[model samples]
Target: MTQTPPEDAPTDAQSTFSGTREVDPRYALDEASLGVWLTANVEGYAGPLTVRQFKGGQSNPTYELSTPGRTYVLRRKPPGTLLPSAHAVDREFTVISALHAQGYPVAKPWALCTDDGVIGSMFYVMDKVEGRVLWDLKLPGMAPAERRAVYNAQVDTLAALHRFDPAAIGLGDYGKPGNYFERQVGRWTKQYRASEIDPIPAMDRLIDFLPATLPPEGPTRIVHGDFRLDNMILAPDQAQVRAVLDWELSTLGDPLADFSYLLIAWAIPGSLRNGLAGADLKALGIPSVEEVVARYSEKTGAPAPSNLDWLFAYNLFRLAAICQGIAGRVRDGTAASPQAKSMAAQVPALAEGAWSFAKKAGA
Candidate 1:
């Protein structure tokens, strides 16, 4: 019999951005236009630029910008019709800029371009952080001790983020305070309806069940809406996180809710695509989901919430909705990555997972 992967294991594909492919034609930027914009807006920019798209992200079209002196990363909104407030590149720039200014491990902000005439969509440029971006939650190819350290570092970073005062950091208005779960559930529900293609009964159940089971409001902090191991760039030789990438979904929300969302990776099994559910965690020496939560609570000095299971179910519901949206985009020819179809294919399984946890909420 195979030992199961711990329920709290992080889940992401093991990959690198080193082998960036030619820019997808639909999302391509005119180098001349981009060069002109950079020259005008970005400082110290002298460029005969080369551009290639990174392979990892599922939402935004991320590209590597090469200049004679240095390389930068460009994140742009996907071209085509979009649902309201979906691809908010401007918001991404704002959150990352604010965090970087306060010595947070985020990519250094360079400039934000809103003139759609230049790139066909809103976009931003930031320093290209050089580090190991381990896509696999298991930290494949690493020693067990190194894997443990990496996981600890990830949790520590998350705690540090929650501990910061968003107001003092100029992010007080980043998102509405309080009732975050309510707002998020409403938002994703609308998004799901807008992009609905297939009928998912579990998703329907969640849309109805979540509101009826609302927990007491928790404290708000700036939540990295899509926090996970792959969303961070780790130090090349050590377990330290160099920069947290992808702020497209960052906002003010219940910190425990955000942390609970991270814990979903553990609930996902390794047998499933983009899941780590069935891997052998004991041999890998990865901590269980319970241990990870305990560590976070200890580090942040916040007790775990009484309705923690409910929050987990809510997060699972949100993720399934997100994947459903991706499926819609794929069907409509607006998906950013080719892998969107595969990701979308997992929506039913995700919905079932959400329903399973929802049932367990009161047990």
Candidate 2:
């Protein structure tokens, strides 16, 4: 179902500079202004040139810069106000840089600037990556032969991330690893409370049941934080995932939490919140909850999806809370999307799914 933007999304002004983009006012950058910022931060830059706001982000505002001999992607926090953690461009850059050493798929980093004087906030630059975003494809429109292959490929790439050890990649201090389940419940519950304009009863219940009912152990790994079809760029005409983008919210935590988010990203069979751009949940052989549980079981040798219902419910609640945050931005006049607004409206319905998934799975 269409839901709010994912959690761990950076939505503040200071966060805007780190090379991601979200809802923000259109601001034109003059040559001199651009030159000042570029020279101050980026090295070996001859002059400041044209900068265009990059689309395709729901958190920070991203831009592309054209220099005399090269191109770069610039991500920065949103221009207006933001939350406490939103201004973490330095942290985002540092974490991603560290993770690069460890077998994780990521873009090559160029520079990070925390000085606010250059561009009104912090920012970073990386080599531009090109590939298919792979988000809006509908299963019904796909050739039948390609459906199962694509779906299976998605799962395996995710499994690859879980295969990496955080410390092996020099991410030992990137983020703390313990207390995954309780932290998730607490973090999302707080987001729900802060972003709530009205009370959603199912959310409260899902929040309460999650920690108490679910098991308490999982291995720590570098969670892509926003892993989904759209976030992964694939090779041209190949099913293999190339680089996984958007590690801003990534941290050392339980891989299953990220896995559950991926599960929810797929269209649930016969559900009203089916994928947003017409990706029929039924056509893609979108793995059933049981199948997903089994696959992860085989791969990780972890516990079977025992609290399937709890995970399903909690995931939706977390999604709804995230949507509410974006909806708040819309109210503030920063974001513009009919679908985003519509998704925010669906929080209650998504919460309903949360409740149903919880009960159906005997959670």
Candidate 3:
């Protein structure tokens, strides 16, 4: 159920590379139909409409809708045949709708339309959020202390999500109950094979090795499959996360997987395009990886996972598979971004990096 983003933003990373591009013809909307539909269903809808696609979000095609009165954001599944369970606009709508209902920091969901005839695909509309979506891991433009607050806010938000009970929020059945990593490994493995271009030995090794050495499943909370700086929407003038955007990969699963996924930035070398692996943590005023984990543990009152190495390698491998799927979409001409090929090229390096971690863990 994965489709990679078009640009080079982190796979699970949602915030990045601001500004919109001309919508690809393949995913363009029927504006007349969309306007008519909105006029009838959405409250306070206004006349002539214009649409431009957001540059980020790989799996779902997101657009900004402008009318005379206000602006709205539309997220839709891309056109053409999709990988199994990929581009799930419905699931995204479900999770976001529930979260919004509870006054969570999500873009307020307006409506979801499943009839493809309206826009040629299932889509949902939400209030357009005006905020800074920081793309850089280094968090340029911010003072060191501000960078620290940004990271701390991110950590606190993640812990808060983990501490909430899914059942209490009406998401108990959001995903399968047990064996999240097992199911995810098998799922990503299938997704990778579906989009496989050329065989990478490291990917092959991870597919074979991860299952045999799965870590113990911790608590099953609402896991944001992709929870990193870019995936979040920060306040326009502050370091706090205004809204947690992109629910395409979110589901009920091990919260540690979500937390550890954020920590992967520390392991990735600064030589890599979109990671903080080898950056100067103290100079940047960003918390060290250890600090991130410790803060999450302290906030949630749960110690960091004992087998973090396994979780880190697993999350990296999953991200690599996600990138490979984007490559496949590019080859098929169904990709949403022009940067798909360059992003796909990073797959081999990502897989190799994951394998290095696995080797360290003796998996």
Scored by TM-score, the top model is: 3
What residue runs in model 2 are displaced by over 4 Å at the alpha carbon?
A: 1-24, 27-31, 43-48, 137-142, 266-303, 336-339, 361-363
lDDT of each: 0.81, 0.64, 0.83
Per residue, candidate 2 scores C-alpha lDDT tens digits across 64-167 of: 77777778777776556664564356766877677566645667777887776666667788766766555443434456556556666777777877877777
Q: Which of 1 and 3 is ahead in TM-score? A: 3
Per-candidate TM-score against the hidden true structure:
0.94, 0.81, 0.95
Q: Write the per-residue lDDT of candidate 3 for residues 252-298, one digit (tens) a residue.
A: 99898888888887877665435687788899999997888889999
Write the residue-wise lDDT of candidate 1 on 1-363 in tens digits: 001112232244444323478898988888899999899989999888999998777678999998889999999988888888887889989999888888889999999999899989899999999988776666668788888898899999999999988898999999998898899899999998998997999999999999888887778899988888778889889989999988888889889877887777777766643355777777887887778889999999998666666877888788777887888888889887666776677677777878888898852
Q: Candidate 2: lDDT over CA atoms?
A: 0.64
Weakest 10 consecutive residues of candidate 1 by summed lDDT: 1-10
Give the TM-score (vs. native) of candidate 3.
Answer: 0.95
Flag regions of model 3 displaced more than 4 Å: 1-16
What's the TM for model 2? 0.81
RMSD (Å) of each candidate, 1 decimal: 4.1, 5.8, 2.7
